[model samples]
Target: MELISSDKRNQLFERFAHDAFHLELRDDYSVPNEVGPFEDWLNGRESDDSFMAPWLQLMKRVTESGKTVRRVRVVTEPHSPYIQWEHATTNVNEEAGELIRWLPRHKLPAGLHFPVDGNDWWLFDDKLLAVGHFDDGGRVLGSEIIDAPEIVAECIRVRDLLWSIATPTNEYQL
Candidate 1:
């Protein structure tokens, strides 16, 4: 698996031709950069949007270009503190124009098929995938790029299925 760096991921985003869809399966993420802000949030601090500004700017630029940015997160209900933190901060992304939805884990159909790898990923233009890699502690390592049509197709099918049933952020609450 070839790992792509964060800078390269930005390049992929800039170069994607159409929509970008993300599937987030993890309930918790131990992102080093988010430690301080996450702690602040836990202590009842709110973003003046500074911590999330770069990503908000990126999402704004993408959507203003007439492209779509969407995400479907499969969350475990009675949410993890990390997920609660994410949910609270999601408004930044929404304000920047990314569409997000949530699917409670138990709501998914039993015996449903999943991509063989079953890793969280960003599917760009329904073609290329930036498959995520994480350490045991849930810190991101990086992403591996995959452009296989068969795999991308599976991801798209999963995305379509989840999007159809997932609750829009406004209606979802822990």
Candidate 2:
């Protein structure tokens, strides 16, 4: 397996933010120290509309493309307020209900998957894989933490199984 650098991983996320599909596994999305990059991306839209406009357009396109974007978050303790704010402010929860769906630990989508290990998050596209590890400070201790091919394959498999058992959030509400 190829080892991707932290800078490269950021670029990958930016790429994903633009066009590629994304999958994230975390305890919650709102850790201020942990979500710095994502927060930067979100805040950029407010300051430099031009910078995030294209990505926003791409997000709309992806949502309309009928391609499934999956995120599996292992909820533990109190949920992240930042994540809640993000979901609420961007209306990602409603939009995600419509476009993205949750996968249970026992099942997963056809081509995507990941385990719910604490702080171990993986982002997958057709060929590339990005992994990140955060310390208690919410600072990224390292993103190039996992490089073993077998580990990647295993994570993908685990994600698939979970997706199969997962339920869409909207379905449970009503």
Candidate lDDT scores, in order, read 0.87, 0.47
RMSD list, candidates in order: 1.2, 7.3
Summing lDDT over every window of 10 consecutive residues in candidate 1, give the lowest-scoring window.
Answer: 46-55
lDDT by residue (1-174, candidate 1, tens digit) is 789876678778799888999999999975767888888878888645476778888889989998999999999989998899899888889989999999999999897776846789999998899988888877778899998899989999999999999999999987
Compare the candidates by lDDT and give the number of the best one.
Answer: 1
Model 1 TM-score on a 0 to 1 scale: 0.95
| Candidate 2 lDDT over residue span 1-174, tens digit each | 244555566455444432233345554544434345456555654322343344455445555655444554433234455544333334443443223344333333465534435345554553345666666765555555354667666766665655556555555221
Report how far off residue 6 is in candidate 1 (Å).
2.2
| Candidate 2 off by > 4 Å | 1-7, 13-25, 31-58, 61-68, 77-90, 93-99, 102-118, 145-147, 172-174
TM-scores, all models, native as reference: 0.95, 0.52
lDDT of 2 at 83: 46
Residue 161 accuracy (lDDT) in model 2: 58
